[model samples]
Target: MNKAPIVFLIGFMGSGKTHLAKHVSGILTGKVIEMDSEIEKKYGAKIKDIFSEKGESYFRELEREVLYEIIATNIHSTAPVLISTGGGTPCFYDNMEVMSGAGTTLYLRPSNIVLLRRLEKEKEERPLIRNKTRDEILEYIKQKVNEREKYYLKADIVFNPVNPDIGNLAQLVKEIIYSSFPYFG
Candidate 1:
């Protein structure tokens, strides 16, 4: 039997990576591995607490370790594995290269307006934008998205979802994945 494909969903926070992963996994009967949740579980702390206590450098190291561990454990599975990575996952280390080499990387590109609206409501939960005002949050999104575009664009598939609904987006992603890897379908 062919080894199942690992689909890495890459995008900014609030771009629906986790939602997409869960939806796609349901459609594909795959496993969803949320990188941040895995790290939080492994360290026994929430990500915000981890960042506040250990610094981003330390948190990034942990992210790298978890990314590799996820790949190693799931790379040869007989069912699909959908990995929903943190916003900064691909921008650090050789993560983009590693993910692309291991399996398909799908970048979910949404407009800045869409991101700002979604992120503003959830700022308290996100460490990077927790204390920012509305304008500051928008500025931060623009700057970070610009900086991370290079890494995100390196994905094998770049999907710009005009309609951000999970059902439609998930169906689109499923079709793209099937087209890319026919055997998986």
Candidate 2:
């Protein structure tokens, strides 16, 4: 029997893709394929280290490969996993094309101020963003968000990071999936 297609969560840093992906995965009986974690495993280092040592250009190559692999691997995977990608995944390379082609792409949006706060707390863990100041981070987010919005807008669904409420975020995910495409259930 043919399995359902995969789902993708595309957004900026601190936009909450990982958190939401986990929720939807549970509700959908799908696995969560985290692109960043896959890269770290291949290189045997943290994502921050990959950026620091190999640089963004190199990391992008790995990102593309992982995205491709995830889709190919899950083409026959029942339950269909949710993919949480890095902030820049859509901006660079052909990742956006691959993601949108693979399955549904959802955008998880939070306010810019909220993102600033979230990024501030974890900049160290995200080396590409560690050197940016508050204003710079905000500006960068604005610029990147603007650029990626075109791709993200192609998603099958969009949700506010706060509206569904984090506590029930998982439930919301399932509800969205079931309601939007009940046949998948």
Candidate 3:
């Protein structure tokens, strides 16, 4: 029997990692492990609350733990596994290394303009940019993405588009998977 492959999606917030994972899951036929949701479930608090109460340092630590646990579970699972990770996951600690070592990592990079629009509407729910002004939010995204690009670029594959059209995204993802792992085809 062939063991399942762990597919990890990494990108900035509002880059549509979760949505992409959901779409890919339909094609791949596996459980989608959303890191943020898992963290909330395991810690009994939303990520914003965790960051507020315990600070980002604590949240990062918890994220690391949860990532490891998910990887362990994926190792034992018979079905293919897709992991939608938080924006900052690859930038923290040795997460990028761990993810690359364990599975195929895809970086879904959207333009700064796209990210600003998405994040602005949902900033209140996001701890890091919740307090920033519109201009600040845009600037922050530009700077943060520049800083994190190095880590994100280490992924096995990157879907860098100014604005990716969702209509054919699933088929595109399938192509990526087959190209990356020919045996999967």
Candidate 4:
């Protein structure tokens, strides 16, 4: 059995990190943990409600705690683990540092257009960008992508994950898995 190699997936919201984690977890032979879902379960409320009620600070605090806890799990587990971090996970705290130190970090790195398209369809589910116009979504993505680029670039591996063939992403990740682990270079 392949031991858990500590894979941290990072990207903007709707960039498919969680979806890709699901796929990768299936084929890559690892347990999966999603930071957002973990937080929601812990708080017994949706992340949107948490943000609205307690403000982003509280959510950030919870996110940090969860990410650290997940990192600890990976450190102790013997099997390869796939972790999907929140969109802003790396931007705040020393998450990038923790991730880089503990595991291989991969950025889903979807294009703004693709991200906007995916986000538009799911806006209702995500209160942060709900009811936003297409133009507004585009602008928001641009600003977010810009602000988060520095944090995102800290990933050991970055790839454009959008495509006509989603399965290709799994192959790409597998290639990375075989050729090199993050921070090994």
Candidate 5:
């Protein structure tokens, strides 16, 4: 088995990191490690509960720890690992640097309008935007993305205005990675 770098997907909440990771996993020999799902499974508590009970600081600590553990495992594994991080993961705690060092980071940057539309539908499940009104969500996305762009831009590759077609994206990503590292047969 070829020891490929982990593929870390980062973006805003509604930017489709998880969805894209699933698509990419089909082409790569990687299992998906979705941060939020892992956290929920491990703690047996929803993220919103974790936030309300333990606070964001504690949640961030958990995120950092889980990320490090995943990276360590990836270091010893032959197969690639596709890690879909939470929307805020890259923006805090040297996460972007660590992920980039351990693997390939991809920023899925959909338009803010697209994010708003998607997020508005999933607001109830999203802790950060759950209580926000439509107008608030629009403004929130704009401000947060502006704040986080510096970190997101540090990724090895960025897919802006990502094509809505999952198959096309998976193929494109596969081609890019294989061409970049010609040793992969």
Candidate 6:
């Protein structure tokens, strides 16, 4: 079997990166590293709280630190490693370059309508759109997605699922990795 030691999942908020990472890890028997969760655990504060207290720049710095830490510790791991990055992770610093160089980078591109619907349900949990009205949130999603697409499109693999099936998606990723590094087996 081909083993991709690390796989980074990048996408907009509410794009199901964490969920897909968990599913992929379960299938591959790998470790799942949620960057936002890691930051929250390390700093002892929710992400929204971090954004409010320390600001976006501080939070982005923390994100960069956590990303490097994860790579440094897991680069040589024997088992697969699935990393679910924050929406803006790739857009900051040289994160896109670092993650792409480290291992496979997968971009999860869901439709804007889908993102809007998902974000609406969990707006309060998201610091960026927490205070925005429904209409404002839609506009924000459109604007942010357009701005972030450049960074996100730099990923090695882009998986745009019309209706994402976690199981199938995980298997597809495995197949892609297997194809990419046939000598790994």
Query: For model 1, how does the per-residue alpha-carbon lDDT over 8-115 read when each residue is reduced to its tens digit?
Result: 999999898987878877787667789999999999999999998999999999999999999999988776778899999999999999999888999989999999
Candidate 2's C-alpha runs over 4 A off are 1-3, 179-184
Please provide, for model 3 over 87-162, each residue's C-alpha lDDT reduced to its tens digit, 9 standing for 90 to 100.
9999999999999888889899989988999999999999999999999999999999999999999998888766
Report the lDDT tens digits of candidate 6 across residue range 100-140: 88888999999999999999999999999999999999999
Q: Candidate 6: where are CA atoms >4 Å away?
A: 1-4, 181-185
Error of 2 at 147 (Å): 2.4
- Residues 1-185 of candidate 5 have per-residue lDDT tens digits of 43345778899899998887778778875477899998898889999999888999999999888888888877755555678999999989999999888878889999998999899999988878889999999999999999999999999888885457888887777776555445552
* Worst 10-residue lDDT window, candidate 1: 1-10
At residue 30, candidate 6 shows an lDDT of 58
Task: Provide backbone clash counts, one per model.
Answer: 0, 0, 0, 4, 0, 0
Report model 1's TM-score to 2 decimal places: 0.94
Candidate 2: global Cα-lDDT? Answer: 0.76
RMSD of each: 1.9, 2.4, 2.3, 3.5, 2.4, 2.4
Q: Candidate 4 on 1-185: residue-level lDDT in tens?
A: 32337878899999898887777766765577888999999879999899878988889999999888887767866556778898999999898888888878888888999999899989988767887899999999999899999999999888885474657787677667645533222
Q: Provide the TM-score for each candidate, comma-separated.
A: 0.94, 0.88, 0.91, 0.90, 0.91, 0.93
lDDT per residue (tens digit) for residues 1-185 in model 2? 32246677788888988877766666676577788888889779888888888888898888888878778888766565678898888777777777776676778878788788888888778786799888888898788788878877766677766555765887766666555445656
Model 6, clash count?
0
Candidate numbers, best lDDT first, in rank order: 1, 6, 3, 5, 4, 2
lDDT of 6 at 114: 93
Q: Rate the local accuracy (lDDT) of all candidates.
A: 0.89, 0.76, 0.87, 0.82, 0.83, 0.88
Worst 10 residues of 4 by lDDT: 176-185
TM match of model 6 to true structure: 0.93
The stretch of ten residues in a row with the least summed lDDT in candidate 2 is 175-184
